[model samples]
Target: MTDPANPLVSTEWLEKNLATPDVRVVDATYYLPVEDGDARAEYEQEHIPEAVFFDIDAIKDDSNSLPHMLPSPEVFSSKVRKLGLGDGTRIVVYDRKGLMSAPRVWWMFRVFGHRDVYVLDGGLPKWKAEQRPLDDHPVLPEERHFTARFDTTRVRDLNKILGNIESKAEQLVDARSAGRFEGRDQEPWPGRQSGRIPGSYNVPYTNLIDSQSGCLKAPDALRRQFEDAGVDLQAPIVTSCGSGITAAALAMALDILGHRDVALYDGSWAEWGLSDKLPIEKGPEASASVSTER
Candidate 1:
């Protein structure tokens, strides 16, 4: 079993620890185009009691044309401080689609040098299904001092990915479905092309999670999923998806599984697919070897 005290905290565990002075919960829901409804509007209606809404779009680099790129460290610090997340706060992020968008916030915190954050396994649906409390009231959190330390090593830009195509310095993992990765289906984001970066692997984020429970699969199942997708646990990896959202989901899964040398491609297919010059491959899946260790 993966540790509840690690990158994931159970709904039951959150229920028990939610009131702890240093514990803070965030509703980090970002609705995909297919899933209709305004995230902010839904959050305002009913949410986990005492949970603050962490808007994925709001906490991003507004200067970037892309959707929800990581914000500057100073900006991140300012935004989080307003949310009352300080040095000692243990953040637990949840979302409407189970652990989908919640892990992105989890990754964002880690990228900004805060490691005390965890994602609420199964998220709010599980909380509500278990009859947990909800509060529509807004919380006016007292501003606290937040320090942001940007870690460049955790992110990959387009230039770096282009270099990797030839160098093969790191493995690229696409979190999109096989159909999308293979260019059999169109991209959800308009104007973006389908297909994946050359030499990238495919491990849909959903493979590591249970749709019914909204929680990540057991640790062994997660390992198997990655292994089946040709992900080398021992090698350096960069995860990507459409517009960088699901890529964070892969990062969160890897983090919980205790893999270290992992980074996320901030541009992902959103940027790469839009470009005409960048070379992309569309074809058969790569061969993967499941590890015999353990």
Candidate 2:
């Protein structure tokens, strides 16, 4: 059985317990605008049996111009309730491109006080490579009561991040690629500047995952990745990425490493680079002390 505290579950565990009355699988596939991929259409083509699609774009804060920003508690509750995700359900989120977008959904659930949630380790790619069963039929789940208790501590706003620049109370850990973080590559969004938030450390999200298997690295390896990036594992950290997507992967990795004080910047570079008023830095990050303790 998968531990409740563990943020990830293997494909074997999911295939074994797929028929459990309380288990609910979610397909949270997302593609960047540059990729021009349609997540829903691909989900319609094939997915794990009994899996329902969780459209991050559709269930987001429509009022916000940014992509897939977290919705209000009421909105989240209503949308998830329609998916038959109630208090007792154990949700397992996965995505088409391995682990790319599933962790964000898992983080969203946790942010709204859903503790019985996990990401499917290795996601659909691993499942398919293992020759697991799949289905294309639509699933219309019965509506259920879902309560949302918004947890502010799991998320950080632009203003809070701006304040952190001065206080330095929490360390900023970025999950973007070295090229993008260093401003060598162009920003994905038009009119947005390339470069990272000042005083932030880089731990590219790719470093935390196994390139071949699409699964997250073991705890010790994950710890080393952060340590190599000069992250003090003992201190509070705010993870950020291109649009807050990969940031959740870092947050999940931190949680797995037993680092309790972790949060994610919801706007990420998408918002931070939108204006010239916000401060940004280029080239490699300045080094800092790494904590020896977990």
The candidate maximizing lDDT is 2
Local accuracy of candidate 1 as per-residue lDDT tens digits, 107-188: 9998999888998888888888999988899977877888899999999999999999889989999999988988778888
Off by over 4 Å in 1: 1-5, 284-294
| TM-score list, all predictions | 0.93, 0.95
Please give the TM-score that candidate 1 achieves against the real structure.
0.93
- Go through the candidates in order and give the C-alpha RMSD of each one to the true structure: 5.5, 4.8
* Each candidate structure's count of clashing pairs: 0, 0
Error of 2 at 96 (Å): 0.9
Error of 1 at 275 (Å): 0.6
Among the numbered candidates, top TM-score falls to 2
Clashing pairs in 2: none
